[model samples]
Target chain A: AGDAEAGKGKIGLCVACHGTDGKGIMPMYPNLNGQNATYLESALKAYRDGNRTGGTAPIMAPMAANLSDQDIADIAAYYSQL
Target chain B: AGDAEAGKGKIGLCVACHGTDGKGIMPMYPNLNGQNATYLESALKAYRDGNRTGGTAPIMAPMAANLSDQDIADIAAYYSQL
Candidate 1:
């Protein structure tokens, strides 16, 4: 797990669709709160590396591209805590 | 719009993740029941054409590749009705 404090600041990109609470704004977006951090990190990494290939990847892939390994761990840590 | 009766036969590929009722098998898999028909069709098309690139596309894209426009519409109609 990475620092939750560091992740809080970088989560703005996620709040628009996944929500500030990670509950999500639509049925298509899916919830992120309380999800497994390892799963979340892997998913983010997949999107960043062009492995994840779904309709919503365009929006999420760019966001993942902006994160570092530590940032992914931090973001996953923050959401998993919620 | 498509024939709901026709859609019933084409939804098997979706049942593993989305369930027979389109409710989804896991938290990571989103529910598809009662969602907008148009949204479902568009989502499927997006997955088919490789425009919806997301984590789950790998599973869904290949399935969508086998479906026609009518198949998509019918499947969407079936799920939206559920």
Candidate 2:
């Protein structure tokens, strides 16, 4: 598991869509609060790797493009606990 | 909106992976507890329509293939409330 504090610092890019509390700002976006950390990690990695596509993939791909594995893990940890 | 009682009757195929409680039985699957109903509905529709691909898409596609719009709505409603 990654550090939640570190993840919080990296969530600036995510808050615009997922919100500070991990709830999506729009219906099209899924809420991240209390989601499984493993699932979130995999989803983030999929977005970063260009292995997932559909719906908001176009937007997420770019946002996740620069994330490292540690970044993904941290973000997942933070969101899963929300 | 969908009827939760109706959805419960339709979860026979879902229990193997998502479990009866909407929590995935494995790390590879996502926990559906407390998800947004709209997002869950859209996701189910995407799977049924072949519009989304990646990760568990292959598995989900077949499972969702026979679902009608009402089935999707009811299932989403049931899972979102879990």
Candidate 3:
């Protein structure tokens, strides 16, 4: 759960929107810094599987679709520590 | 968004920890229904101005320092119309 290095590579695309610090670039983006890992995983999966919707969903869907389970886990772990 | 009956009476202490359709009944509590009423009033004024900590921030800093700014904008417009 502490693999920040691996998560960095996997979540590279997210930085454009979520910011490298995970503080979110805008109010519309949502600061993920210090968010719970379990919650992050659930939300990401929801976005991937079409359970959640928003202006960001279209962009997120494709990005989430390409991630493996491990990738998702690692990213969540990394963001939790941010 | 629309107001949900004065945010169900000023959130009523957030339903003992977010429930009744806002989702989060557990897992560290964080559903907030549909969310996004200016990001739930910027995360409840960043947990009532302490800059957002975990463990529920000492019961959400005395319930958001007694909420008055139109009751946090009508409970963030009633949880963004959850």
Index of the highest-DockQ prediction: 2
Candidate achieving higher lDDT, 2 or 3:
2
Query: What is the total number of backbone clashes in candidate 2?
Result: 0
**TM-score of decoy 2:** 0.88
Q: Arrange candidates, best TM-score first.
A: 2, 3, 1
lDDT of 1 by residue, B1-82 (tens): 6888899999888888777887657745656666667667767887788764556767778989989999999998898787
The lDDT for every candidate, in the order shown, is 0.77, 0.85, 0.69
In the range A1-81, model 2's lDDT, one tens digit per residue, is 777789999999999999989988887789898788888887888778886666677889999999999999899889988
TM-score of each: 0.57, 0.88, 0.59
Runs of candidate 2 with Cα error greater than 4 angstroms are none
lDDT of 3 by residue, A1-80 (tens): 43677998888779898877886666556667666676777667766776544445566778898777688889988887
Interface RMSD of 1: 5.5
Decide which is better by lDDT, 1 or 2. Answer: 2
DockQ of 3: 0.12
Query: What TM-score should be assigned to candidate 1?
Result: 0.57
* Residues forming the 10-long window of minimal summed lDDT in candidate 1 chain A: A27-36
Which residue ranges in model 3 land beyond 4 Å of their true spot? B1-9, B13-15, B18-28, B31-37, B40-73, B77-82
Task: Order the candidates by DockQ, highest first.
Answer: 2, 1, 3
Tell me model 2's lDDT, rounded to 2 decimals: 0.85
Model 3, residue B45: distance off in Å is 19
Candidate 2: interface RMSD in Å? 1.8
Quality class of the docking in candidate 3, CAPRI style: incorrect
